[model samples]
Target chain A: MITITGLQKRFGKLAVLRGIDLNIAPGKVTAIVGPNGSGKTTLIKTLLGLVRPDSGTISLAGVSLNGDPSYREMIGYMPQAGKFPENLTVSEVLRLVKDVRRHSGPLDEALFEQFQLAESLNKPIRTLSGGTRQKLSATIAFLFRPEILILDEPTAGLDPVASAQLKDKICRERDGGRTVILTSHIMSEIEALSDILVFLQDGKVFYNGTLAAMIHSSGETRLERAIARLMEGGDAA
Target chain B: MNTTTVRIIKFEFSDVLRSKWVLIYGLFFFLLTETLFRFGGTSARVMLSLSNVVLIIVPLICIVYGTIYLYNAREFMELMLAQPLRRRSLFGGLYSGLVIPLNLSFLVGVGLPFLLHGVERTAHLQAFSMLLLAGVFLTLIFIALAFLISTAYEDKMKGLGIAILSWLLFSVAYDGVMLSLIYRFSDYPLEKAVIALTLLNPVDLARTLLLMQLDIAALMGYTGAVFELFFGSIMGAAISLAALSLWVICPMWLGLRQFRRKDF
Candidate 1:
């Protein structure tokens, strides 16, 4: 489990996160959903230590997020619109990450094989299509079998078949008892995969609970309508 | 320094090798040096001509290339940031990756021609070594400046523009300004002042060191005498080198501080 308290962050004069307090449970999928500029990405990046918060305490599995970076070993992060060194071939890039990892159990090639990544292994990253790059991102995120997976807009550019395959992978990972956190605009993807919905608004948490509860409490059957109601200032907490 | 940093450097170096730009850069130097040796008469005279060329070229190329490379690698840096990597390690890796390959290309590109031309005399070899040493220092100093500009500016063109402007300030404009100052204040006891001022511009520091070694301060006229009188000593030479190294370190340290705090 990951615990966060009084988390606050500001970029210059603009505050992106405001006193966020939450617990992200393990063995479940949590989807942070919000409109653009609603602090979803900032909160995620703070957890990843990509952004430093103004005030906060974040502990992963009871270990504080201090300057020491070893805790990140258990987390896998897939950036939104992942970009890589253009000239490096796919396999070389993989090798670089593996070398940086410096430790390995039996390799998790399940997603790698499922994505048919071997066929594209020799091609440089610049040559890969958007979907191919997305597939590669997903492959790497799951490759280490990390305890927590943080994926940003994972299904944005994927084809329907690839999207379904990724959704299946997310479910299987969650079933196998790893914590998964993701942010997406697609309500159906949220409804289908996530166990808990953390709705963000104006840099604050508007609602945090299950999708079914959000839908039922907001008097809307659809996740999209429920979120829309929340955005329109309907309190469903 | 750590294993992760080493791995990053290793991959980055291999990737740079495959790009072929460094090879081309080395080739350019080899051709330039060879052509100069062919046309520029005696070896000593050729070294002097090469010194002038090195003063203008090294800073220009290192600053511009380093800036563009850093800007281009921003996405790659972002990718690395999300990994289980320290910013310090990442910075070290990125820095050494470029610095090592670039310095090697420079050494081999410029060194091969002189070796082939048989600069075997010890004095000639020592002077050649000083020239090469100066080039390396200028490269180190300017690349650090480039890193500062690259990290400080978000826009590519702004970073690039500042990079070119800095090269111009150091290489071309600085001399014009200094010469004018010396002429305007020619009446004053300005030898010490000139020495102090020259130390401020890394290019001038490097040039003065080379000229002092060549014992050809006459080419610089009055101000050159001031330089020869002061920086002509062994201690002065060491001081100039230390200043040049500071030029390299200060900017890199500043750039690293910014990089550590910068948001992706």
Candidate 2:
């Protein structure tokens, strides 16, 4: 339920997102994969209104998001590192988010319980381990049951159990007809979770299609090999 | 003034209050004031001595603390930006969050000592109030200046360097340049020029305000007489207060503009 046209972003002389035109439909997981410095984060940041595009328009369900922050309420974003105020406790961070969102619905304590964060409620964020921090980030992202989820490397530091729990949560969200946009380096996670794949190269979309279509076109059965071949093939022509 | 703004301010203020550095800052002031009182024979002498100390230390603390806090709060700011909150509220919250606790700390640390020492009974009460007022103004002015510098650059070291340099320029170097200008233009009519120059630097403006109210024109020489003529009256005091307020507003406005347009 998002549309971006002619989106270009440049950091000084380096063009990060060059002429991007993308559409993300609802009720599906759209996995964005790319090599390092391929503007995946920049593209996501632009959609979140964190990075102002040099030239382009991003509309959410046909309404322009320029200078309007209210649209962000529909988006639940989990940043890559999940850096929080060091002094605030886990529960405090959650409470702060809940306060900001003003969500009146019954709180989703599933991820909170799954991650076993209840015991660590009083522990400061600085004291939490990296995996616990990721759990906290994951819990907050799904806490509001938002219409859309934008997760940047959501499982980067998550342990195996937490990661599986998160993967299941993503699938459940997709089944519930919620849109999810995620970026991850793990090929298997993308293959298992995403319905549509958008591969980026050098600040431009190199390939966009279903996993089956990408494999068929690349003449490779495996998703990773297909992506590698697609990178070598160029333009997906 | 929305709930989000209030929440942010509450969160930030409590977070900063819990920091040991802020406690150390308050204790530092408490100890310094107590020491000044013990050493200086008369209450008037103590107020004058504390003015110099306040002039130098308050701006330094505000600049250093403000820059460090802004840089440290980068992640928290990013988190808030992703929320459904307005940019104005976020910024307003963060600014007030920093300013309120700092103002309270100064009031408690320094004001308590003056009240306890019974400086209110003496003629130095006006000077004491002036000292506290100037301290508050300088704290705000330097904090705004720090925010401006922090927002302008991406590099933390560079931002901090510029902030410290700015504090140096206003507190120490500005006075040196002003003196040199006065000496060089001794033959020219520089009363109005000197007054204008003094207003440009918040530190100098504060010192001039306090010194004028102290009525020590003979000790201050030519610039003192000019200041007395202009700042001796209520109108001049109002003008100086306005000028100092401008120093706080102009930089903060510019910084907030930059903050709004900034890409996190």
TM-score (all chains, Cα) for each model? 0.96, 0.95
Q: Which runs of model 2 end up more than 4 angstroms from their true locations? A: A235-237, B120-123
lDDT of 2 by residue, A140-237 (tens): 88888888999999999998999999999999999999999999999999999999999999899888888778888888788999888877766465
Counted clashes in each candidate structure: 0, 0
* Candidate 1, backbone clash total: 0
TM-score of 2: 0.95
Give all candidates' CA lDDT scores.
0.87, 0.87
TM-score of chain A of each: 0.97, 0.96
lDDT of 1 by residue, A57-167 (tens): 999999999967777889888888878888888998788777776657887888789889999999999999999999888888888889999999999999998899999
Model 2 chain A worst lDDT run, 10 consecutive residues: A228-237
